[model samples]
Target: MLILVTNDDGVRSPGLRALALSLGEIGRVVVVAPDRNRSAIGHALTLDHPLRAEEIKPDVFAVDGTPTDCVNLGIHGLLSQRPDLVVSGINCGLNVGDDISYSGTVCAALEATLMGLPAFAISLDTSLFSHADLSVSTRFAKKLAVDIMEKGLPEETFLNINVPFGPCSGVELTTQGKRNYGESVVVKEDPRGRKYYWIGGTENGFEDLPGSDCNAVHRGYISVTPLRTNMTNDKTYAVMQQRSFACMGDID
Candidate 1:
């Protein structure tokens, strides 16, 4: 089996390297990632500017674009053979709740799913960016990758795995966490009298909703959430269809 790997934290990210190294043991692994950190970039594609990709080593390339670009380019242009699975991240920080919407890490994996391949996005939950041995997370990622390789995924579905910091006891199938990101964005002025913004805040630990990814992590457990490509709220759609805006009798 062939596996394609990419991340939003750029080619040099330790998490990216750890994931690639572990995946290499199971199958042919190729790494294609952005040249610079593209965190929270979402699923953006480079259209206006010309995207440049430089091959840094055998089976490893870096693109001057988003995480989505790297994955798209990997399957379409770089890889000599189409990959059976696409795995993204081992992201430095957590991507739970609404974080998935703005995560380039998840976007790379999602792009691969769009191209008809099983995909996964993995992240490590940590507050500080420090050197941590990723052996445990890498091992877990490899196991999951092999599982997908053996079992295969359902149509139009992808997996989002978030590993908690420190030793993990086991995996818990989870749902997207509820995040109360209070006053998250901070507006500021620079020394040159320029307006700037910093995205910063502590995650609210309080949520009545249990069995969420964030809650799981808060309790020190690895969270594995299955995500579907279809965003339609079937229950809500059914209810909305019954309510009509058209008038039955109107004066002409």
Candidate 2:
């Protein structure tokens, strides 16, 4: 099997390299990732400017764009053979809860799923992004990869797995968790006494809900949440279908 590995954390990230090497044990590995950290870029693509992908090493390419770009280039243009699966991350930080909407790590997997490939995103929840942290996380990644190669995921879905900072007891099938976005932005002064805004800070708290990814991770279990490329709310869609909304068409 050919595995195309990419990440939002950049080409030189220890986590990215670790994941590539771990996946390498399973299949042929090709690493195409951002030349610099493109964290929290979401599913953005470079449209106005030409994207560049440089071969930094054997089977390793550094893209001058987002994680989404790396995956698109890796499968569509870079590789001679089609990749059987796409995997992103072993990211430096946790991409659980509401973080997924802003995570380029998750977006890379989304991009591959959009391109009709089986994909998964892995993240390790920790402050210590050391090689040892990666060692623990990549083990979970390898296990998931083996199961994916054997069982296969459903169409339009990709796994978003988040492993705890230390040893996890086990793994769980979970739903995306929710967390209140509090103190996400900070305002500060520059050297010139000018105001500058920082976009994000620590999240406050996770909802007290069961079977959520956050809960599983909090309980020292790896959280495997299957996310879909489409954001449609199937239950809401059915309910809306029964009601005729004037907004559905031109206003009379």
Candidate 3:
């Protein structure tokens, strides 16, 4: 079996290394990741500028692009053969709730799903320098990879896995949760007295929704949320179908 491993935390990330090493025990692992951290970049493709990939070492390539770009290049460009699975992360932090929409880690898996591949993004719910033992997450990743290869993911669906910081109780299949976003922009003055703004928000917690990814992680359980590439709201589509728009020949 061949596995493509990538992450938004860049090529040198310990989490990335740990993930690659752990999965290597199961199959041939090729790592194609961003040269620098590209967290929260979402599913952005570098079409405006040319992308560059450097083979830093055997089976490892670093691209000067987003996580999605790495997945694209890994599957279509770098590898000798198509990978059986694409696993993004063992990320530096958690990607849960509404934040998954803005997560490069999750989006990497999304990109693979778009290309008709089985994929999953796994994240550790901890700070970058927390020195958390990643054995649990890596072990689960390998197990999940085996399960995926055996059972196969549903058509057009991928998973987002978030492992808690410390001891893990078990695993929970969850839905995307809601976040309490607040006061995101921070205003500041530069050395020249010119105002500058920072775009990060203080962590404002999440909605107390049961059976949610955030809730599962909060209880020290690994959260696995299945995501689909199609964003169409079936209920909304049904509602809109009831409201008929008979087009008059011409608008005055």
Candidate 4:
């Protein structure tokens, strides 16, 4: 099976390399990623400017774009054959709770899922960026990938997996959780006396929500949250239909 591998942590990130190599044991692996770190870029696509891609090695390419661009380009242009699966990340940090909305890592997987391929986003729950020996996580990813290759996933569904640092208790199926942040954006003056803002914050709380991805990670369990493409609010849609604001017999 052909497997497309990409990440937001950049091409040279050890997590990305390790994941690619681990997946190679099971299938043909191709790596296409950003040349530099593109963390928290979400699902941004490059349309304002021309995108650039370079083949640094066989089956490995670096693109001057976000993770979403990598997946979009890799599938539509780079790969000679369509990939059976797309495994994004093994990212440097966890993408739990509301963080998924801002995560380029998860966005890469989502891009693949949009193209009708089974995809998964894996992240290590560590604060340190240098922590790269993610053998355990890679193994877990390989196993899950194998299962997906055989059984396939539900339509429009992708898996978000977060691996806790150190010994993991086990895996748990979970739902997305709400994450509250405090002092996230900080303003500081640079050496040039210009004000610069840093966008980051510490996790405030998850309310210890049961069966939530954040709660599982906090409890040292590997959180597997199934995500889908549809974002429709059925209840709101029904309410709006009942309200009937539109004039049915207009244009007399």
Leading candidate by TM-score = 3
For residues 1-252, could you state the per-residue lDDT of candidate 2 as single tens digits?
A: 999999998999888888998988989999999999899899999889988889988999999999998998898789998899999997888888898999999999999999889999999886557634677678778888889889999999999999887777888999989987788889999999999988766556788789999899999998999999889999999998899777768856
What lDDT score belongs to each candidate, Candidate 1 first? 0.89, 0.89, 0.93, 0.91
What is candidate 3's CA lDDT for residue 31? Answer: 95
> How much does candidate 1 score in TM-score?
0.93
lDDT of 3: 0.93
What lDDT, from 0 to 1, does candidate 4 have? 0.91
lDDT, candidate 3, 1-252, per-residue tens: 999999999999999999999999999999999999999899999999989999999999999999999999998888878899999998988899988989999999999999999999999988863579999999999999999999999999999999999898999999999988788788999999999988864665899999999999999999999999999999999999988677754567
Spell out the clash pairs found in candidate 2.
Answer: none
Residue 33 error, candidate 2, Å: 0.0
List ranges where model 2 is wrong by over 4 Å: 247-252
RMSD of each: 2.6, 1.7, 1.4, 2.3
lDDT of 3 at 165: 90
Please give, for residues 98-176, the per-residue lDDT of candidate 4 as tens digits: 9899999998989888889999999998766575458789999999999999899999999999998988899999999
Report the candidate with higher TM-score, 1 versus 3. Answer: 3
Return the lDDT, model 2, position 145. Answer: 86
TM-score of each: 0.93, 0.94, 0.96, 0.93
In angstroms, how far off is 145's CA in candidate 1?
Answer: 0.8
Question: In model 2, where is the ten-residue run with the lowest total lDDT?
Answer: 127-136
Model 1 global lDDT (CA atoms, 0 to 1): 0.89
Per-residue lDDT value at 134 in model 3: 93
